[model samples]
Target: MSIKALVAHGSTNGSTAQIAERIGEVLREHGLDTEVRPAAQVGDVAPYDVVVIGGAVYAGRWHRDARRFARRNADQLSRKAVWLFSSGPLDASAAQRSIPPVAGARRAMAHLDAVEHRTFGGCLREGAKGRIARSLITSGRGGDFRDFDSVTAWAERIATQSLGARAEPERGDLRT
Candidate 1:
């Protein structure tokens, strides 16, 4: 059976969504069937063999949509290979060092038994929605801080791990 992966993210100003899409792309490049969707739009997790969930952080809290998705699909997620990510630091901090998951993401990671969690730099540019986003842009504190290379490296690591592990047959399988 082919492995199917889902990359679902909760992005407020679309930066996190782009990161999620890039992850899906990397997974697909490694031969896994992958789908990228907004967390709120994903109705179920049963179709995927593995799942990668991410959200944009705001004031140290993860996006609500991501939290809801994890809660709603906790049971299914716990049974599968799961990974989590956060994108919210509008600076180089995320790329320079490991940024831990925010409070909500940490809770979900425990509940879902996720294999790993990553934090990526965030982006904010002109025309971004939300007052805070606008303020940050005006205050010269906003820009595209996302590191696509780091994102790609992380996804490649996931593909390598997943592909290697999945190549091994289960204990009970008998071959002629």
Candidate 2:
């Protein structure tokens, strides 16, 4: 059977979505069939063999929708090969720096045997639709900082490892 991968992300200004697409591209290049979808659109995680969950971060926290999705699917996710990523910290400096997830999320993720979890820099658009988005963007905090190469490399690694694990047969051969 062909390996299947699901790339789900949450975005406010489209940066996280772009990152998700980039990840999907790399996975496809690595020979895995990938489906890139929004977090809200993901109906079920059980159908996918490999699940990549990512979202944009604001004010040191992931999008509420994304967090909710993770929480709702925690059980199913724990049973499968799962990976998590966050797009935050605009600019190269932020890209290199490490920012821990919010206390609540950290606690929630403690039990998950996640294959990998990463934090990547993301982008911010100039205009904000409301007070919160505008404040975060204008607070001298938001800008495009995503490292496409790094994102692609990580996706490649996941694809390689996931596919490799599936390729191995469960039982050894006994020759006559």
Task: Identify the leading candidate in terms of lDDT.
Answer: 1
lDDT of 2 by residue, 115-173 (tens): 66788887877884557767877888766788888888888888888877777777221
Q: What does the lDDT come to for candidate 1?
A: 0.90
- Write one digit per residue (lDDT tens) for candidate 1, span 1-176: 77789999999889999999999999999999999999999998898877999999988999999999999999888888889999999999998999889999999999998999999999999998889889999999998889999999999988887787677777221111
- Ten-residue segment with the worst summed lDDT in candidate 2? 167-176
Q: Note the Cα lDDT for every prediction shown.
A: 0.90, 0.77
What is every candidate's alpha-carbon RMSD to the true fold?
3.4, 4.6
Model 1, residue pairs in steric clash: none
Query: Which residue pairs come into collision in candidate 2?
Result: none
